[model samples]
Target chain A: MSNRREIEREAEHVLRELSKHLEEIELEETYHVIDAESLRADSSPELRRGFREAALSIAPRRDGAHYVAEAGTWV
Target chain B: MSRQALGEAEENLARRFEEIERRDREINSFIELNPHAQEEARRAEKLGGRLAGMTVAVKSNINVRGLRATCASKTLENYVAPYDAVVVERLRREGAVILGMTNMDEFACGSSGESSYFGPTENPSAKGRIPGGSSSGSAAAVAAGFADAALGSDTGGSIRNPASHCGVVGVKPTYGLVPRHGLIDLAMSLDQIGPIARDVRTAALLLEVIAGSSREASMLDVEPQPYSQRLSADLSGIKVGFAKEYEEVTSPEILGVVKRALRRLEAQGAELVEVELPNLEKALPTYYLIVFVEFFSATRRYDGRRYGYRIEEVCGEEVLRRIMLGSYISQKEYAGRYYRRALQFRSLIRRELLQALEEVDVLAGPTTPKLPHRLGERLTPLEMYAYDLLTVPANLAGIPAGVVPAGRVNGIPVGLQVQAKPLQEQVMLNVMLAAEGRA
Candidate 1:
């Protein structure tokens, strides 16, 4: 895997090229943030049942209570 | 009386399943058959509702408990849904039997259905041409008579594109009109699950059942209207707007059919008005810039530990390309330049559509710029994105849009897209009903 520095460098290169392409289009609209409604999560029993069902269907690499993950290597 | 109706529906359901078994090898519309469909049909026979005994094929991206919700990607090829999507629950509650999971573009990314890991769906209307996608199978299932109707998500023309090619009716309901609680979203802001069926009434009926406020707070909170009840064949004094900008981009063959459709509406006593949509050229760019970013964000959940496989390693080329482009566009440095600008432009497109709808009851245009090409034909990603050019504006604007079989070009079906203001699905469907009558 690429290190942080390498990933940042690649990202910079991509932004440079992409920005140039976007610059060709002249935008007439001024910047303004459109207000989107905040999502309200339901904690009802039905929703809990749905979540439990989804967790059960997730591809198995999990313990009964928690998902198992690959151990990370540290430098 | 209900028992007799149930018996008839069971017969119809059995016949449809058998037909799917025989012809689906060639069509490839379905990914997995609901093993409990016959059992569900037997149960549906006892239920009473508008959709009682109807076979509804759901696109694989939408969750149906005990069925693989793959989104036609190898990444989730074995991932069975544990819960029904809000729309699926509503449909089942109303007595519709879930027939199977239909194929779609992997992660709902590609327009040409060929990006599906399950294989591209064949257009039943045109022998060798592509079933326009990413709702390719849902449209094909209805067109092929495998289902009475099917539900497909429309982010940017996923439902209408295939509906046009497969000669079926498809609706991309106003954004947020249908709850998205269980939809495997392509782009959260743009995705709305709608119905594809052989006729306008069935599409409208399914839309009525699936749309409106749900237990989840994701819907628009608008009081649902009886959309199917309001559909009318009458078009007297109804004003239909024909956008000149749509004409500039559409192919000559496709334009020929749409023009005939406009004339038919005129002959039916509907007044036609020429509307200017100056920002049509910019819509495609604006649509993709937002979708790419939103899609990228949505796919972050596909890490192998939780889902089937890590998306980056297993996704199709089109999906990978979107993720990369989205990642590039969403960089902190470039977010204002690309992503923010696209969002601002979205407002402009929405404003233009809202203004146009104030003048006309509905806006009519060709659903796709060109007819679908043959499967396996190589196209640049830009070419594939162009398939949604006409249909994306509605998604961008969060307006109600529907497609009806207008006419055919070279024996392949072409659709006339109709659009109305948000929450005005009745007007859009009435226009579609009139158009279907003309056909």
Candidate 2:
């Protein structure tokens, strides 16, 4: 688990580096919290897409009055 | 003598107390076992009700009024619940004495229950093995006999995994069947408060107290069932579907045990059939992506604000990871990409489950693929995500699921999962009780 180091070059974005060091697929890996200021001035559509996908998965979807979200999988 | 049943129960409680004192030191199954449980037991006996003298341990996530709901995380440390969680309030209404709040993975994140700031909970069934978690303490509390039953939350497999590994009964009620108002949210859409007990009948009793509508908080958005109190044991002609997707994901040993249990159900008169839940294979990644994003949003309130703890400062490893992922995913730019795709997949899975249920009354399988791991055994987030293979469908479909002790594999107990359609707990429990040979 690489702790965020804000040294000569500060970085933003949760370092996807934790994705390395290969562990068992069912195991829990460390959550990365980056400095708020480190966020990229601009994000790629790919990054945006991943986050959007994740968000819609948990976000409540409402249609007028009824909560129409029967889509996301339960954890 | 009905009143005196309390006295006898107190005596039983005393004996159990001595045992908990002796065994608890080794298992650490309890975060807090009320020192006055016996007195409360006697009082409950005098109250004279269905659960009058029964002892219940609440998961740290469920509020017990004066007791703290830490969600087993340091984030909520020192935060005693100002009011009772809906289930706790219901338990109190029924004359049930809460033993104490049990430990869990912080913020209900880990499957191993190792992410607690207090300490890792040990598996009660097989020594040196992890009590499957998120609901580690809740299941272990019952497995260790520290409490008669326990209320636990299952976002994914928290209750079922621990119950499976600990040789106990754990059930995740259909979402909305039980209110969530007082319970802390991990992922509001997915988090469900449930019961962990030694047997299915007792679990039903606890569910009775906790399930239903409150004036303000209806755990289920709609009343799925009027009462989950009286689950029938009759599965004579019920149809049980075995999901084809589970074959590639389940362990042979686990499946072998589950198959025997299914055969037992068949012998008891259930019709076994093969069913398809095509999207279930994608449910793990889909569930994780959703949990990460939502959990992050839920924790945002804890940024050293009105909430008790700053997660970045005090939350455990799994939680922080999720917060980051959740926060990342919820950002404006990424709104529809990853989160939407997962949601799309989520919809597909739910559609598949509903279609499968149309053909069968319930589904059955091994709750978890692998057996328990030792404390500190490193596993990747994806691997950790795999444990919910069998459980995600229930959550995704917002249905009730029961995990009973099927038997053991290499000394570790395995859970046989029985799931049913939304709000159909009786049908689910009937299938499960028959399957577990509880009749």
- Could you tell me how far off, in angstroms, the CA of residue B140 lies in candidate 2 after the best superposition? 0.6
Candidate 1, B1-439: lDDT as tens digits: 2657767887988899899989999999999999999888888888767788999999999999999999999899999999999999999999999999999989998888888998889989999999999999999999999999999999999999999999999999988889998899899999999999898988888988988898774667877778888888788989999999887899999999999999998888789999999879778878888887899999999989899799988877777777777877777635388888778788888999999989999999899999999989988666777898899999999998999999998799999999999888998898898889566
Worst 10 residues of 2 chain B by lDDT: B219-228
Cα lDDT computed for each candidate against the true fold: 0.88, 0.77
Q: Among these predicted structures, which one has the highest DockQ?
A: 1
Pairs in clash, predicted candidate 1: none
Estimate, for each residue in B187-274, the C-alpha lDDT of model 2 and write its tens digit.
8889898999998888877787777777767454554343445566677889999987788888898888888888888877889999
lDDT of 1: 0.88
CAPRI accuracy category, model 2: incorrect
Q: List iRMS (one decimal) for every candidate.
A: 5.1, 10.2
